[model samples]
Target: MASATRAGHRWLKWVGFLCVLCAIAFAVVWYARNANGNEPALNTVAVSRGDIQNLVSATGVLEPSNYVDVGAQVSGQLELIHVRVGQPVSTGDLLAEIDPTVYVAKVDATRAQLKNQQAQLADRKAQLRLAEIQFQRQQNLWREDATTRESLQTSEASLASARAQLAMLEAQIEQTSSTLRAEEANLGYARIYAPMDGTVVSIEARQGQTLNASQTAPLLMRIANLSTMRVRAQVSEADVGKLQAGMRVYFTTLGDAEHKLYGELQYIEPTPEVTNNVVLYNALFTVDNQEGRLLPQMTAQVFFIQEEALDVLRVPVSAVARNQVKVLDAKGQPQIRAIETGISNRVYVEVRSGLNEGDQVVLANRDPRAGQGESRAAFRGMLR
Candidate 1:
């Protein structure tokens, strides 16, 4: 009975081992058949002829094309402000007025002095005429031997002295007239006038404020033309070389959420600005604002349109492998071809010398059969 029991136990153990082996083989075969069956192939787009533009983006500010600071030319208390901030003014429009009482008085005094000198000059002219007549009569008498030589000499000397006095009086009148003109000019400066046609943007001088013009002219107000504005964009020194005058550009202001302004490049600064270890060059362009939407100092988002290709062959940048594009040859076989690329904004690299429109370029592996699943798994593992 013991021998029979031992044989049965050994046999049951062998049977159990064989069943585990069969189960392992079945699992291996199942995994081999289903491992990569459920993934889709890559999606590709055909290269087509279309317009491609290379652009550089930057930020800038909108400023007036021309702005001038209206300043006080004469010193006095500000009595009146004829224009308010944002008021449109024409050239010679009254901007402000300084207290002109003192200047007017100075002008009056100078005019009185001038008038007095003029009256004196008239009297001198009369004296000169009388002296000329006397001298002529004395000369006639002397010629006729009726007057003594000494008397004739005395008359000539008197005439010469009167002429000298009259000339001196005339010089004094001229000096007084110059002084009067200067005083009048000063009086005119007391009333400030707009130097250009623009809108008042700033008012630094207040009513009753005293301005001192002994040194620099004190700022009174600022006038700017808002109908047209300029955008001063800073392009990096590296990219500035690509920008040139007359190139087209577009910009959007932060305030104008939906509108974009287009313009041509106007100017480029030869010098670069170095700030915080970065160098940038200034680029300028003008935008028309007939709608009166743009304001001075408003931030603008700028784009420099460097190059544009129209109706040209273009493919996704990723479609190019190793700077070489892979496409199906005439025989429907995979082949690689070298291509020359043009300006790229890093998103779409333009194919300049290779491939034509309607050619198919293979994009990166989206194909499930191309071992992408394993690649993705490896990538995920690396991330962890």
Candidate 2:
């Protein structure tokens, strides 16, 4: 009977021990849940000085700063194309030639007519000289009463006819000379020359191609100076108002995104281009292309800088909320403070005030010990 009582006492002791263990486990879980356990750890960043820019983005095309279309001023068959596409040329360089056979023949005909007019003028002058001499002789004879009045009168009429004939010949010679000059000019136009220093960008006329410049000058080729390039950026209507003349801008080519070519805004066209129901304005700028890297009609990714702050206090945009920021004190405790921001690039913002250099800005807060102390399943079960 004593042995049975001792077994019962041992059973009770085991039960009590199990109850105590259950109470201890419950207490631990309750403490873990109530002791700021669910709070997230603090993510922080240091306030530092950096560069920031407020920019407007747009697309553009590169074109030569100066360009001209070389055309045929007079009509003829294209005899030669002295330059190929991309050939370099200077002013007065012979670019090409039209078949000058017709022009040459016209010039020859005009020249021969001019010579004929000169011969006629010479013959008329000789006749006028003879008439004047005879009239003088008649006057002298009349004064001496050695010639009849009728004969003197006839001589005077002859002199006047000769003078009229000479004047007519002179007018005809002048008209012929003017015609000759025009024909000579046409002959010269058969040979085309570069009017400016540039590279031949295009050739519209080929060898032996017939060109008729009567109505419009036939486009023979195009020449452009590639030493400087102009960027024509298409700015959206919403952003075009923010742009102004003489502002700084830069661009990058699709093939070379890493390298930026910069320039100042030159002009903004008053007209807008309506494409696919989108209104876009043209903003122009020029960039020095001494390296000859830019080409005509190349695309550019452009940025127009509105405002910029250099070597200024800055922080990530996420760190600032509602013109206020949470900064960690020296003791690593977060405290909210009102802030003033200047320029923002959507990624980083300029910290105008309320944040000191090297100050820790708390992005957010969390419990650092939450993950370490409990398994995911245990924490979940405790919550349930």
Candidate 3:
């Protein structure tokens, strides 16, 4: 009976100890859950005053503002090329010369023909003068009854025929003079002259090359005014509507990306080019290149500034979700608030209202301690 009583006492003591442990475990789990639940889980950024710009980007090529293809007007062997590639030329400066031998020969032949016509005209005029003198003398003789009326009529006929012959020769001479002028002009075409002041950008015709101008004018060289450059930007069809003439724009070459060349949007081509079924429209803008740094056919990264806000309260674009922001209030509590935004680029957004400078906006929820600690606490509570 004594052993039974002691065994019952020991079992009761063990049960009481287990009950105390259970209470301690429950208290720890409750504290963990309550403490971690009160903590915020988020990363934040401050809204600050800065400049923001909305820009459209596209790739383009640099082209001369004014350029021309110099070609040969007459067919002959290209004998001399006076200007080389990259040489600067002035107006009326000799650019090249085709073989003038054929053209010169044609001019000489025309001149000879004109001279022959003029000589024939001079002879016809002399004969006309003689016919007039004879007609007058025969009339005097007929009045004195010293010559027959038939002789007088013959003199008059001779005079009229001589005048007609002289008129015909004069007409022939005038026609030959015109032909001579045309042949001389063709001879001048043999010597190519610079039509404008520019730099020679290309030379297509080589010395000793034969040119055929019968069908089309054979290109000899290319001249361009490099003082100004036009950027031909290929903008996507989606962004074409936002662009217009005189819009603010700038560009940078691949070689010098840090330095930008500024200009206004000058034109947008009405036609769109389709490549691989992707439509693209061309936009042009001009930039002054008085220093001659810009060149033809250079690749440019163009930026069209659509809208800009200066010294405005802005936040990272990622912080705003659907025009709503999660921000930490003055009491350090997270609150969801609607915000009014103006212009935005890919990286930042301009906050027009509902957010102040130095305010903290949440980007994401990130709490390392809450994840593991809360999970363990929940598991412990389940066990209890």
Task: Tell me, by TM-score, which candidate is best.
Answer: 2
Local accuracy of candidate 1 as per-residue lDDT tens digits, 1-384: 999999999999899888767766775675566675533433557777776788888778999998899999899899999989999999999989999999999999988888888888888889888888988999999999999999888888989999899889888888888888888998999988999998999999899999899999999999998989999999997888888899999998776657878999999989988999899889999999877788998999998888887766788888887779888677655578899987655657778878887787778765545664686577557434
**Clashing residue pairs, backbone N/CA/C < 3 A, model 1:** 41-367, 42-366, 42-367
Model 3, 179-253: lDDT tens digits are 888888878999999999999999988999999999999999999999988899999999999998988998899
Lowest lDDT block of 10, candidate 1: 36-45
Worst 10 residues of 3 by lDDT: 364-373
Poorest 10 consecutive residues by lDDT, candidate 2: 364-373
Clashes of 3: 0
Q: What's the residue-level lDDT of 250 in candidate 2?
A: 91
- What are the candidates' C-alpha RMSDs? 6.1, 6.2, 6.8
Question: What TM-score does candidate 2 reach?
Answer: 0.84
Q: Each candidate's lDDT (Cα)?
A: 0.85, 0.90, 0.91
Error of 1 at 355 (Å): 8.9
Question: Candidates' TM-scores?
Answer: 0.79, 0.84, 0.79
Q: Which residue runs of candidate 1 sit more than 4 Å off their true CA positions?
A: 1-39, 46-50, 311-313, 322-344, 349-362, 366-384
The TM-score measured for candidate 3 stands at: 0.79
